[model samples]
Target: MPGKPPLLFDEAFLRKLERLSLVARRARSGYFRGERRSTRRGQSVEFADYRNYVRGDDLRALDWNIYARLERPFIKLFEEEVDQTVHILFDASASMDWPPHPAEHHKWNYARRLAAALGYIALANHDRLTVAALSGDAFTPWGPERRRRSIHRLLAFLSDLPAAGQTRLVPALTRYAGQTKRPGLLFLLSDLLTPEDLRPGLSTLQYRGHEIALLHLLSPDEVTPSLAGDLQLQDVETAARQDITINATVKTLYRQKFDAWQGEIEGFCRQRGIHYTLLTTDRPFETLVLHFLRQRGFVR
Candidate 1:
């Protein structure tokens, strides 16, 4: 019999993740009670403010001390604690399976590990998390589950996902925004190789009240190509071919265009108040999570 597959995350790494939790810069409304503090005022131990007592108000909420001093009834209000809905959108398109050799650092593998780590953090903090893999026209999803017990299911779901088909970001995102009723935090992990204008999809999510964070993943090979001589490059997803000579001028132009493309995406994100981070698969997983993500304010 074959040996069992290795776990996506070791116990030591999971324990480290337990120390962190997803951060939402602004308050969000959730259906279930949890650790996150919300803007909505409700019954909780932490005091919010006091308001003049109105008819039919709960007598138990009346501030006896204020009543004695002012001879007027006042109701004590408390800050509401609620769960956050965290959505992780993973891109499993063909381009993400690049650099066929060295499977460990493949874009697909790196992205899956990152998703698993983030989902675990949310689970540890009792936040509702939904993970979806987007490819072609399909959106495969798992969980709106919370708590550490759900980590196993999350890992299994992520491990089984395969990268294939073209990435159709707009339709997939638009459909998700329409289907998901509650608005919260949304993290999109993708290489963003699609030619479609992403503004429509991103704007839709924002309109639905989601706090969006775009993790633009790329491989080191893609970022800095070392190819020389004549080359026939084919699009991984579309299979279109292009023949070009790999000369000094060509390489210089390629680098300039690549940088411009990245700048365009960054500018768009900044204008829309969306958090954007560019990541290369060559980076260590621990550094990406423990250091980079923390610096980005995604976790604390």
Candidate 2:
């Protein structure tokens, strides 16, 4: 609790979330009624189809004009609104907690803010929302909270998760997919510096019929190197050290490698139909959520 950062959102920010809704990606029918449109007909203003009126059918739905001409009663059917379950998983790895420099923004904290904002969008739209923390430890999942009133519980759970341990994302995802009875959308926020290949976890989620979006988080130091002289870079999880000098040539190569990595990730996600976005802690998180995310079809 002492090390935890406050969820960086205010009333105005939440108001923005209220204004936006997740892009209407076709999702599986939910267990309970929600605000999103469903395949089945229910009671919305949008008229879909009509059928011969049954004795028990609501009289309000009767087509008076058609009945007057044909001497037959007909009922109207409107599209149903089904709930969507939005599951957001935060990579609580040690690297996420360790910023490359103290002055640099905290990756874990920024990730928390992004996760909270997205979760708020779901709950505010009356969609079922679940936030989960993933590491080598057992997965810690917060509620499938529904509606705006559940925001406090979502905020509380998101703010409390600590970024620690190695990233066992694949195992955690495998377990989750196995247990989940209904399919929904999933947003994964992580640096993705795992020892194992990330493809397996992503593929598993996709195979489970989930619309997956991976928002890869990075720090300014990670995107570029401003350091001079020789230094030892330590791996936060394994404590493994690599000693190197920060020469101009080395820095240039570093930048090139980083660019290449981004390209490879984008290519991979594109091939797999995963909505991949690169987010840096340097820029405004709201810009990514409100502008870039919408542009990429994450929200509308």
lDDT of 1 by residue, 81-109 (tens): 32568899989898888776435567887
Once model 1 is optimally superposed onto the true structure by TM-score, how far is the C-alpha of residue 195 displaced, in angstroms? 1.1
- What tens digits encode model 2's per-residue C-alpha lDDT throughout 1-300? 137643355676566555554332211122122224554433345454454565565597699999999998876545343256788988988889856433337888788878887777666445668888887834788887765678878877877777776878889888887777666788889998776777887898889988888899988888886788989988888889999999999999999988987888889999998888888888876666777655754443
| Candidate maximizing lDDT | 1
TM-scores for the candidates: 0.78, 0.77
Model 1 bad stretches (over 4 Å): 1-7, 10-82
Roughly what TM-score does model 1 have, to 2 decimal places? 0.78
Off by over 4 Å in 2: 6-36, 42-80, 100-104
